[model samples]
Target: MSQKAIIEALKNPDAYDEKVFYVKVLQTHISYIFLTGRYAYKVKKPVNFGFLDFTTLEKRRFYCEEELRLNRRLCGDMYIDVLPITLSDGSVKINGSGKIVEYAVKMKELPQEALMSELLKKGRVDMNVMDEIARILSDFHKKAETNGKIESYGSIDTVRFNWDENFDQTREFIGRTIEHQDYSFIHRAVQEFLKNRKDLFRLRLRKGRIKECHGDLHSGNIFIADRIYIYDAIEFNERFRCCDVASDIAFLLMDLEFLNKSDLSNRFLIKYLEYSGEEEDFLEVLPFYKCYRAYVRGKVTSFKLNDPNITEEEKERSKEIARKYFQMSRQYAEEIF
Candidate 1:
């Protein structure tokens, strides 16, 4: 069924047990998030966006299971299980024991204020929270599995490919939405870094600095309730999530800076370094990784222009955001060299 039809069905009282269950659509992006009473059900959208493929029922089920399994590593109590939505006689029901039409990864619904992005926006965020989050993430990274066989991650060729692919993909949107000044600066900086940092990249690889990590570790993906919850891990692809630990931590640092919380960012970085005993190594890669993270943000913001639901004003705002991130990327690159 189409997304609009699914959304419409959710609003109908006849579609569910009204007294016992209620469905509230929370977020609709790559996935559809619904609040079913105390739990949130995340259903993967049946769209193949190259980077994420969940077009088939089997693929959705597989990813749902993967999401539950990976998320349980951090949020064991919160990530309950993957349940199938059954369709029978033109009606859809959760755990109906009928023909499975869709699957959702059920999770304990966390409060909005608990999310780091929301907390930061309200000026309710504190250094203590960042410190705790850093510690939790550091511990998770320490325990993460690594592949001794894969040596490409630490090589200069691979590092160049990462930056090259990012810029090549985003270059088309440069003059269209992103400011020309910002784009020029980023273009120059990326080229300069590629020319100078070959040895450093190889050294990091030999040191085993690369490992499986949380691909998307921004403020929006973190939560601090009774305990820190690092949710929304990249379960769609291993390559995106598997990288240098510095790159993973860089995402959070960039997010903090973007939120205008540099003090918290500093504190978080310091705390993470203290616990992991890798401050010098982190410093060496921090600027480059921050650049990478900022460019990723620019690309994502630029995508808003393609969203039909977004108004012209919103598209303009997204362009401004994209320009700002591109400028930030340039600044990080300059700092590195």
Candidate 2:
């Protein structure tokens, strides 16, 4: 079945074994997620944009499995397993006895109100919450896998490769969501940092600070329930996942700053450094990583304009958001470089 057909078929309650009253659907750039009452199933779309590729069924299955495995590192209880959506006698059913038409990452559904973002908006996230999140991440990073190959991703060349790819990808959206001046400045700042700080990158690599990490560590990916359940890691590309631990932690800190909660961001970073026993000079390289994270966020939001399904109002809103992220990137760059 095609993606459209699968989406349409999954809307009915019969598609799932659970007794669902109504099935809700949500989509991101790469996957369509169907939310049953008791569970959620995510199906990757057949799209490849160089950095991320889910163009084939086998590749999708592989990524689905990868998602399950990598996310289990922290939020083990939330991720159930990857299951095949089989087509049988002209009917599409999840995990049915027939030829497999698609793969989905099935997960135990948690309440929306439990998300850290929602809690943040409600003024429920305080310094204590930040400290707990810091401790969780610090512990995870300490135990995270790292080898010579993983440490190499922390090299200056790899850092340049990731930044260059972002610039190349976002060039088309210069006038739409990002200003030409902002793009040029960010490019120059990144290149200058790369050229001048080769030793800093090597210092990070030599510290054995590189490890497989949760690339997407924003508030949305976190659930402040009985425990801190961080989900939806960057599973498609090892380039994003395997990097300096500082780079991984910079994402959430940057996100807090985006929410105008720099106090919490500062507290979180301090707690993380304390818990992890990271070197004091770790602060020296953080602004660069924060700038990288923010600019990539802007580029990602700008890509939403390409989705035909998005309403005009949402596109306009995304444009505003993209601009803000780019501005944040510029601020981070100007602060040091």
Best by lDDT: 2
Candidate 2 wrong stretches, greater than 4 Å: none
Write candidate 2's Cα lDDT for 55-172 as tens digits: 9999999999999999999988889999999899999999888999999999988777999989988988889988998999999999999998988888888899999999999999
Tell me, by TM-score, which candidate is best. 2
Please provide, for model 1 over 52-171, each residue's C-alpha lDDT reduced to its tens digit, 9 standing for 90 to 100: 788888999999998888788888999988987777788877676667778878888887678879988889878888778878888888888778644455466666777677777787
> What is the Å distance of residue 284 in model 1 from its true position?
1.3
Report how far off residue 321 is in candidate 1 (Å).
Answer: 2.4
Clashing pairs in 1: none
* Local distance difference test scores for all models: 0.78, 0.89
lDDT for predicted candidate 2 compared with the true structure = 0.89
Backbone clashes for every candidate come to 0, 0
Q: Which ten residues in a row have the lowest lDDT in candidate 1?
A: 12-21
Task: Provide the TM-score for each candidate, comma-separated.
Answer: 0.91, 0.98
